[model samples]
Target: MSKMIFVNLPVTDLGASTRFYEALGATRNPHFSNENAACMMLTDTIGVMILTHDYYRNFTQRPIADAKATSQMLLAVTVGERAEVDRVLEAASAKGGRADPNPAQDHGSMFSRSVEDPDGHVWEIFWMDPAAVPGDSSTVDA
Candidate 1:
Protein backbone atom coordinates (compact mmCIF):
# COMPACT_ATOMS: atom_id res chain seq x y z
CA MET A 1 0.00 0.00 0.00
CA SER A 2 1.19 3.53 -0.65
CA LYS A 3 0.87 6.42 1.75
CA MET A 4 -1.08 9.47 0.66
CA ILE A 5 -0.64 13.04 1.91
CA PHE A 6 -3.63 15.17 2.70
CA VAL A 7 -3.13 18.91 3.10
CA ASN A 8 -5.89 20.21 5.29
CA LEU A 9 -6.75 23.89 5.05
CA PRO A 10 -9.31 26.18 6.58
CA VAL A 11 -11.40 28.06 4.07
CA THR A 12 -14.06 30.67 4.49
CA ASP A 13 -16.19 29.20 1.71
CA LEU A 14 -16.12 25.61 0.53
CA GLY A 15 -17.76 26.28 -2.81
CA ALA A 16 -15.53 29.19 -3.70
CA SER A 17 -12.42 27.33 -2.60
CA THR A 18 -13.48 24.35 -4.67
CA ARG A 19 -13.76 26.60 -7.69
CA PHE A 20 -10.38 28.10 -6.92
CA TYR A 21 -8.75 24.67 -6.64
CA GLU A 22 -10.46 23.42 -9.79
CA ALA A 23 -8.96 26.36 -11.62
CA LEU A 24 -5.57 25.22 -10.46
CA GLY A 25 -6.25 21.84 -12.16
CA ALA A 26 -7.51 19.92 -9.14
CA THR A 27 -10.74 17.98 -9.16
CA ARG A 28 -13.05 17.52 -6.23
CA ASN A 29 -13.24 13.98 -4.88
CA PRO A 30 -16.95 13.71 -4.32
CA HIS A 31 -16.47 10.51 -2.34
CA PHE A 32 -14.93 12.53 0.48
CA SER A 33 -16.67 15.85 0.02
CA ASN A 34 -19.55 17.44 1.89
CA GLU A 35 -21.07 20.82 2.66
CA ASN A 36 -18.47 21.50 5.30
CA ALA A 37 -15.46 20.52 3.26
CA ALA A 38 -14.27 19.72 -0.23
CA CYS A 39 -11.61 17.19 -1.07
CA MET A 40 -9.45 18.51 -3.92
CA MET A 41 -7.39 15.81 -5.52
CA LEU A 42 -4.21 17.20 -7.10
CA THR A 43 -2.74 13.79 -7.74
CA ASP A 44 -3.31 10.23 -6.63
CA THR A 45 -0.69 10.72 -3.95
CA ILE A 46 -1.43 14.32 -3.05
CA GLY A 47 -4.78 15.74 -2.02
CA VAL A 48 -6.09 18.81 -0.27
CA MET A 49 -9.08 18.99 2.05
CA ILE A 50 -10.47 22.48 2.25
CA LEU A 51 -12.69 22.73 5.29
CA THR A 52 -14.76 25.55 6.62
CA HIS A 53 -13.32 27.50 9.53
CA ASP A 54 -15.75 25.87 11.92
CA TYR A 55 -14.89 22.37 10.79
CA TYR A 56 -11.14 22.99 10.97
CA ARG A 57 -11.38 24.66 14.33
CA ASN A 58 -12.59 21.39 15.77
CA PHE A 59 -9.25 19.79 14.97
CA THR A 60 -7.22 22.25 17.07
CA GLN A 61 -7.64 23.93 20.41
CA ARG A 62 -5.24 26.76 19.51
CA PRO A 63 -6.65 29.80 17.81
CA ILE A 64 -6.63 29.75 14.05
CA ALA A 65 -4.29 32.44 12.78
CA ASP A 66 -5.80 34.49 10.00
CA ALA A 67 -3.85 33.40 6.92
CA LYS A 68 -4.04 36.90 5.48
CA ALA A 69 -2.18 38.23 8.47
CA THR A 70 0.16 35.38 9.38
CA SER A 71 1.60 32.74 7.11
CA GLN A 72 1.66 29.41 8.86
CA MET A 73 2.86 27.36 5.92
CA LEU A 74 3.82 27.62 2.29
CA LEU A 75 2.53 24.82 0.09
CA ALA A 76 5.02 24.09 -2.66
CA VAL A 77 4.31 21.66 -5.50
CA THR A 78 6.51 20.84 -8.46
CA VAL A 79 5.19 20.56 -11.97
CA GLY A 80 6.67 18.87 -15.01
CA GLU A 81 8.13 21.91 -16.71
CA ARG A 82 8.50 25.66 -16.54
CA ALA A 83 5.51 26.23 -18.79
CA GLU A 84 3.35 24.16 -16.52
CA VAL A 85 4.36 26.27 -13.57
CA ASP A 86 3.09 29.35 -15.36
CA ARG A 87 -0.10 27.59 -16.44
CA VAL A 88 -1.10 26.73 -12.90
CA LEU A 89 -0.24 30.11 -11.42
CA GLU A 90 -2.01 31.89 -14.26
CA ALA A 91 -5.20 29.98 -13.65
CA ALA A 92 -4.97 30.72 -9.96
CA SER A 93 -4.58 34.42 -10.66
CA ALA A 94 -7.49 34.49 -13.05
CA LYS A 95 -9.83 33.02 -10.50
CA GLY A 96 -9.70 35.87 -7.97
CA GLY A 97 -6.40 34.57 -6.62
CA ARG A 98 -3.20 36.59 -6.45
CA ALA A 99 0.23 36.05 -7.99
CA ASP A 100 3.70 36.57 -6.60
CA PRO A 101 2.96 38.72 -3.59
CA ASN A 102 6.69 38.39 -2.91
CA PRO A 103 9.59 38.88 -5.28
CA ALA A 104 9.80 36.42 -8.16
CA GLN A 105 12.67 33.96 -8.03
CA ASP A 106 14.37 32.03 -10.82
CA HIS A 107 17.52 30.02 -10.24
CA GLY A 108 18.67 28.95 -13.74
CA SER A 109 17.80 25.31 -13.19
CA MET A 110 14.64 26.02 -11.25
CA PHE A 111 11.83 28.46 -11.63
CA SER A 112 9.25 29.24 -8.94
CA ARG A 113 6.08 31.27 -8.89
CA SER A 114 3.71 31.85 -6.02
CA VAL A 115 0.00 32.45 -5.60
CA GLU A 116 -2.22 33.33 -2.72
CA ASP A 117 -5.61 31.68 -2.53
CA PRO A 118 -8.76 33.49 -1.53
CA ASP A 119 -8.02 32.55 2.06
CA GLY A 120 -4.43 33.73 1.70
CA HIS A 121 -2.87 30.26 1.66
CA VAL A 122 0.37 30.48 -0.31
CA TRP A 123 1.00 27.96 -3.07
CA GLU A 124 4.36 27.85 -4.79
CA ILE A 125 4.50 26.25 -8.21
CA PHE A 126 8.02 25.36 -9.27
CA TRP A 127 9.99 23.40 -11.83
CA MET A 128 13.43 21.92 -11.33
CA ASP A 129 15.87 19.99 -13.46
CA PRO A 130 17.58 17.29 -11.45
CA ALA A 131 20.60 17.21 -13.72
CA ALA A 132 21.16 20.90 -13.12
CA VAL A 133 21.93 20.52 -9.44
CA PRO A 134 25.54 21.46 -8.70
CA GLY A 135 27.45 18.25 -8.04
CA ASP A 136 30.71 19.44 -6.47
CA SER A 137 29.60 19.74 -2.86
CA SER A 138 33.01 20.83 -1.51
CA THR A 139 33.21 23.75 -3.94
CA VAL A 140 29.74 25.08 -3.12
CA ASP A 141 29.71 28.23 -0.99
CA ALA A 142 29.18 27.37 2.65
Candidate 2:
Protein backbone atom coordinates (compact mmCIF):
# COMPACT_ATOMS: atom_id res chain seq x y z
CA MET A 1 0.00 0.00 0.00
CA SER A 2 1.16 3.53 -0.65
CA LYS A 3 2.21 5.53 2.39
CA MET A 4 -0.13 8.19 3.68
CA ILE A 5 0.45 11.26 5.87
CA PHE A 6 -1.81 12.85 8.44
CA VAL A 7 -0.79 16.24 9.87
CA ASN A 8 -2.45 17.25 13.10
CA LEU A 9 -3.10 20.90 13.90
CA PRO A 10 -4.54 22.48 17.02
CA VAL A 11 -7.37 24.89 16.31
CA THR A 12 -9.23 27.43 18.42
CA ASP A 13 -12.49 26.82 16.58
CA LEU A 14 -13.02 23.38 15.20
CA GLY A 15 -15.92 24.34 12.96
CA ALA A 16 -14.18 27.32 11.43
CA SER A 17 -10.99 25.40 10.83
CA THR A 18 -12.94 22.57 9.25
CA ARG A 19 -14.71 25.03 6.98
CA PHE A 20 -11.44 26.65 5.99
CA TYR A 21 -9.99 23.32 4.95
CA GLU A 22 -13.11 22.51 2.99
CA ALA A 23 -12.79 25.76 1.08
CA LEU A 24 -9.33 24.59 0.08
CA GLY A 25 -10.96 21.53 -1.59
CA ALA A 26 -10.33 19.06 1.23
CA THR A 27 -13.07 16.58 2.01
CA ARG A 28 -14.03 15.78 5.61
CA ASN A 29 -13.81 12.12 6.48
CA PRO A 30 -16.71 11.47 8.82
CA HIS A 31 -15.36 8.06 9.65
CA PHE A 32 -12.51 9.75 11.48
CA SER A 33 -14.30 12.87 12.64
CA ASN A 34 -16.18 13.79 15.80
CA GLU A 35 -16.84 16.67 18.17
CA ASN A 36 -13.23 17.13 19.16
CA ALA A 37 -11.63 16.56 15.81
CA ALA A 38 -12.22 16.43 12.05
CA CYS A 39 -10.11 14.63 9.53
CA MET A 40 -9.76 16.56 6.31
CA MET A 41 -8.44 14.63 3.39
CA LEU A 42 -6.45 16.85 1.03
CA THR A 43 -5.77 14.00 -1.35
CA ASP A 44 -6.03 10.24 -1.38
CA THR A 45 -2.82 10.06 0.60
CA ILE A 46 -2.63 13.33 2.51
CA GLY A 47 -4.86 14.24 5.43
CA VAL A 48 -5.03 17.10 7.93
CA MET A 49 -6.46 16.44 11.37
CA ILE A 50 -8.02 19.49 12.93
CA LEU A 51 -8.25 19.07 16.67
CA THR A 52 -9.66 21.30 19.34
CA HIS A 53 -7.00 22.89 21.54
CA ASP A 54 -8.10 20.85 24.54
CA TYR A 55 -8.08 17.63 22.63
CA TYR A 56 -4.72 18.41 21.11
CA ARG A 57 -3.28 18.85 24.55
CA ASN A 58 -4.10 15.24 25.28
CA PHE A 59 -1.29 14.28 22.96
CA THR A 60 1.29 16.71 24.26
CA GLN A 61 2.23 18.12 27.62
CA ARG A 62 3.90 21.27 26.32
CA PRO A 63 1.90 24.43 26.00
CA ILE A 64 0.28 24.92 22.63
CA ALA A 65 2.07 27.55 20.59
CA ASP A 66 -0.15 30.39 19.45
CA ALA A 67 0.39 29.93 15.75
CA LYS A 68 -0.69 33.48 15.04
CA ALA A 69 1.97 34.89 17.29
CA THR A 70 4.72 32.31 16.91
CA SER A 71 6.24 30.10 14.28
CA GLN A 72 6.39 26.36 14.73
CA MET A 73 6.54 24.86 11.30
CA LEU A 74 5.44 25.66 7.78
CA LEU A 75 3.29 23.14 5.97
CA ALA A 76 3.31 22.88 2.18
CA VAL A 77 1.16 21.33 -0.47
CA THR A 78 2.03 20.93 -4.10
CA VAL A 79 -0.52 21.27 -6.86
CA GLY A 80 -0.41 20.13 -10.46
CA GLU A 81 -0.16 23.57 -12.03
CA ARG A 82 0.83 27.15 -11.25
CA ALA A 83 -2.71 28.51 -11.48
CA GLU A 84 -3.85 26.11 -8.80
CA VAL A 85 -1.44 27.74 -6.38
CA ASP A 86 -3.10 31.11 -6.85
CA ARG A 87 -6.54 29.53 -6.64
CA VAL A 88 -5.68 27.98 -3.27
CA LEU A 89 -4.38 31.27 -1.84
CA GLU A 90 -7.57 33.00 -2.94
CA ALA A 91 -9.77 30.38 -1.39
CA ALA A 92 -7.86 30.53 1.85
CA SER A 93 -8.30 34.30 2.04
CA ALA A 94 -11.99 34.03 1.35
CA LYS A 95 -12.41 31.73 4.31
CA GLY A 96 -10.88 34.01 6.96
CA GLY A 97 -7.34 32.85 6.32
CA ARG A 98 -4.62 35.43 5.82
CA ALA A 99 -3.13 35.26 2.33
CA ASP A 100 0.52 35.83 1.52
CA PRO A 101 1.73 35.75 5.11
CA ASN A 102 5.10 35.45 3.43
CA PRO A 103 6.16 36.72 0.05
CA ALA A 104 5.22 34.66 -2.96
CA GLN A 105 8.03 32.69 -4.54
CA ASP A 106 8.46 32.55 -8.30
CA HIS A 107 11.46 30.83 -9.83
CA GLY A 108 10.21 30.38 -13.37
CA SER A 109 10.08 26.60 -13.07
CA MET A 110 8.41 26.85 -9.67
CA PHE A 111 5.87 29.07 -7.96
CA SER A 112 4.61 29.17 -4.36
CA ARG A 113 2.44 31.31 -2.09
CA SER A 114 1.76 31.28 1.63
CA VAL A 115 -1.52 31.47 3.50
CA GLU A 116 -2.30 31.32 7.20
CA ASP A 117 -5.27 29.44 8.53
CA PRO A 118 -7.56 31.04 11.09
CA ASP A 119 -5.39 29.63 13.85
CA GLY A 120 -2.24 31.13 12.32
CA HIS A 121 -0.80 27.94 10.90
CA VAL A 122 1.03 28.70 7.67
CA TRP A 123 0.51 26.64 4.58
CA GLU A 124 2.60 27.07 1.49
CA ILE A 125 0.91 26.19 -1.77
CA PHE A 126 3.23 25.57 -4.67
CA TRP A 127 3.73 23.99 -8.07
CA MET A 128 6.86 22.97 -9.88
CA ASP A 129 7.56 21.80 -13.40
CA PRO A 130 8.82 18.27 -12.97
CA ALA A 131 10.92 18.45 -16.12
CA ALA A 132 13.01 21.27 -14.72
CA VAL A 133 14.10 19.35 -11.64
CA PRO A 134 17.58 17.88 -11.40
CA GLY A 135 16.77 14.85 -9.28
CA ASP A 136 15.66 11.45 -10.46
CA SER A 137 12.30 11.49 -12.25
CA SER A 138 10.80 9.29 -9.53
CA THR A 139 11.36 11.97 -6.92
CA VAL A 140 9.88 14.81 -8.95
CA ASP A 141 6.22 14.08 -8.33
CA ALA A 142 6.52 15.07 -4.65
Candidate 3:
Protein backbone atom coordinates (compact mmCIF):
# COMPACT_ATOMS: atom_id res chain seq x y z
CA MET A 1 0.00 0.00 0.00
CA SER A 2 1.17 3.51 -0.68
CA LYS A 3 1.68 5.93 2.16
CA MET A 4 -0.51 8.98 2.47
CA ILE A 5 0.06 12.37 4.07
CA PHE A 6 -2.80 13.84 6.07
CA VAL A 7 -2.66 17.49 7.07
CA ASN A 8 -5.14 18.52 9.71
CA LEU A 9 -6.06 22.21 9.93
CA PRO A 10 -8.21 24.00 12.45
CA VAL A 11 -11.18 25.84 11.01
CA THR A 12 -14.10 27.76 12.41
CA ASP A 13 -16.53 26.31 9.94
CA LEU A 14 -15.98 22.90 8.45
CA GLY A 15 -18.40 23.39 5.58
CA ALA A 16 -16.94 26.74 4.60
CA SER A 17 -13.43 25.37 4.68
CA THR A 18 -14.53 22.43 2.60
CA ARG A 19 -16.10 24.77 0.09
CA PHE A 20 -12.96 26.86 -0.10
CA TYR A 21 -10.80 23.82 -0.75
CA GLU A 22 -13.25 22.46 -3.27
CA ALA A 23 -13.03 25.73 -5.15
CA LEU A 24 -9.28 25.30 -5.26
CA GLY A 25 -9.79 22.00 -7.14
CA ALA A 26 -9.79 19.58 -4.26
CA THR A 27 -12.42 16.92 -3.81
CA ARG A 28 -14.01 15.80 -0.60
CA ASN A 29 -13.14 12.38 0.75
CA PRO A 30 -16.08 10.66 2.37
CA HIS A 31 -13.94 8.04 4.03
CA PHE A 32 -12.72 10.50 6.65
CA SER A 33 -15.36 13.13 6.74
CA ASN A 34 -18.07 13.93 9.27
CA GLU A 35 -20.10 16.80 10.58
CA ASN A 36 -17.17 18.13 12.55
CA ALA A 37 -14.51 17.44 9.94
CA ALA A 38 -14.00 17.15 6.23
CA CYS A 39 -11.26 15.31 4.43
CA MET A 40 -10.08 17.04 1.28
CA MET A 41 -7.98 15.26 -1.27
CA LEU A 42 -5.14 17.21 -2.84
CA THR A 43 -3.82 14.16 -4.66
CA ASP A 44 -3.85 10.41 -4.40
CA THR A 45 -1.13 10.51 -1.81
CA ILE A 46 -1.83 13.82 -0.13
CA GLY A 47 -4.94 14.87 1.76
CA VAL A 48 -6.08 17.58 4.14
CA MET A 49 -8.43 17.12 7.04
CA ILE A 50 -10.30 20.27 7.93
CA LEU A 51 -11.42 19.96 11.53
CA THR A 52 -13.61 22.35 13.45
CA HIS A 53 -12.05 24.12 16.39
CA ASP A 54 -14.02 22.09 18.86
CA TYR A 55 -13.16 18.83 17.18
CA TYR A 56 -9.55 19.76 16.56
CA ARG A 57 -8.95 20.32 20.23
CA ASN A 58 -9.72 16.67 20.82
CA PHE A 59 -6.69 15.66 18.75
CA THR A 60 -4.07 17.80 20.46
CA GLN A 61 -3.39 18.81 24.02
CA ARG A 62 -1.48 21.89 22.91
CA PRO A 63 -3.21 25.19 22.36
CA ILE A 64 -4.49 25.92 18.89
CA ALA A 65 -2.82 29.12 17.79
CA ASP A 66 -4.76 31.75 15.88
CA ALA A 67 -3.69 31.27 12.30
CA LYS A 68 -4.61 34.82 11.28
CA ALA A 69 -2.27 36.32 13.82
CA THR A 70 0.35 33.60 13.93
CA SER A 71 0.64 30.69 11.54
CA GLN A 72 0.74 27.26 13.00
CA MET A 73 2.00 25.66 9.83
CA LEU A 74 2.43 26.17 6.11
CA LEU A 75 1.45 23.74 3.36
CA ALA A 76 3.31 23.61 0.05
CA VAL A 77 2.18 22.11 -3.23
CA THR A 78 4.76 21.47 -5.93
CA VAL A 79 4.10 21.41 -9.63
CA GLY A 80 6.08 20.11 -12.58
CA GLU A 81 6.30 23.45 -14.40
CA ARG A 82 6.48 27.14 -13.58
CA ALA A 83 3.21 27.91 -15.31
CA GLU A 84 1.41 25.58 -12.97
CA VAL A 85 2.49 27.67 -10.02
CA ASP A 86 0.79 30.75 -11.41
CA ARG A 87 -2.27 28.75 -12.40
CA VAL A 88 -2.72 27.42 -8.89
CA LEU A 89 -2.12 30.78 -7.24
CA GLU A 90 -4.66 32.37 -9.55
CA ALA A 91 -7.23 29.70 -8.82
CA ALA A 92 -6.67 30.18 -5.12
CA SER A 93 -7.13 33.93 -5.40
CA ALA A 94 -10.33 33.47 -7.35
CA LYS A 95 -11.67 31.37 -4.53
CA GLY A 96 -11.38 34.17 -1.95
CA GLY A 97 -7.76 33.50 -1.09
CA ARG A 98 -5.08 36.18 -1.17
CA ALA A 99 -1.57 36.26 -2.61
CA ASP A 100 1.21 36.01 -0.12
CA PRO A 101 3.09 39.25 0.43
CA ASN A 102 6.40 37.94 -0.86
CA PRO A 103 8.36 37.98 -4.07
CA ALA A 104 8.52 34.96 -6.30
CA GLN A 105 11.90 33.27 -6.71
CA ASP A 106 12.98 32.88 -10.31
CA HIS A 107 16.43 31.39 -10.03
CA GLY A 108 16.36 29.95 -13.56
CA SER A 109 16.20 26.58 -11.88
CA MET A 110 13.33 26.71 -9.45
CA PHE A 111 10.30 28.96 -9.09
CA SER A 112 7.94 29.44 -6.16
CA ARG A 113 5.04 31.58 -4.95
CA SER A 114 2.64 31.50 -2.05
CA VAL A 115 -0.98 32.26 -1.16
CA GLU A 116 -2.86 32.65 2.07
CA ASP A 117 -6.17 30.96 2.73
CA PRO A 118 -9.04 32.76 4.40
CA ASP A 119 -7.99 31.28 7.72
CA GLY A 120 -4.44 32.55 7.22
CA HIS A 121 -2.88 29.18 6.53
CA VAL A 122 -0.08 29.65 4.01
CA TRP A 123 0.01 27.48 0.93
CA GLU A 124 3.14 27.70 -1.16
CA ILE A 125 2.90 26.58 -4.74
CA PHE A 126 6.23 25.87 -6.43
CA TRP A 127 7.89 24.27 -9.42
CA MET A 128 11.38 22.80 -9.62
CA ASP A 129 13.21 21.34 -12.57
CA PRO A 130 15.10 18.23 -11.61
CA ALA A 131 17.69 18.77 -14.32
CA ALA A 132 18.32 22.33 -13.20
CA VAL A 133 18.11 21.60 -9.50
CA PRO A 134 21.31 22.31 -7.56
CA GLY A 135 23.33 19.89 -5.43
CA ASP A 136 21.32 16.94 -6.59
CA SER A 137 23.61 14.89 -8.78
CA SER A 138 21.83 11.70 -7.83
CA THR A 139 18.86 12.73 -9.98
CA VAL A 140 18.85 11.56 -13.62
CA ASP A 141 16.75 12.48 -16.64
CA ALA A 142 14.98 9.94 -18.78
- What's each prediction's TM-score? 0.89, 0.93, 0.84
Clashing pairs in 2: none
lDDT string for model 1 (1-142, tens) is 6799999999998887898899887889999999999999999989999999999988998887788899878988888888888899999898867999766679988899998899999898898876776795334364
Locate the minimum summed-lDDT window of 10 residues in model 1.
133-142
Q: What's the lDDT for residue 71 in model 1?
A: 80
Model 3, runs deviating above 4 Å: 134-142
**Which regions of candidate 2 fall more than 4 Å away from where they truly are?**
140-142
lDDT of 3 by residue, 2-105 (tens): 89999998898777678778766679989889999999999998998989999999999999888778865677887778898888888888776788645777
Q: Which model scores highest in lDDT? A: 2
Q: Output the lDDT of residue 129, model 1.
A: 76
lDDT of 3 at 101: 46
Model 1: colliding residue pairs:
none
List model 2 lDDT by residue over 1-142, tens digit each.
9999999999999999998998777999999999999999999999999999999999999999999899989999888999999998899789889999999999999999999999999999999898897878566453
lDDT comparing candidate 3 with the true structure: 0.82
lDDT of 2: 0.93
Count of backbone collisions within predicted model 2: 0
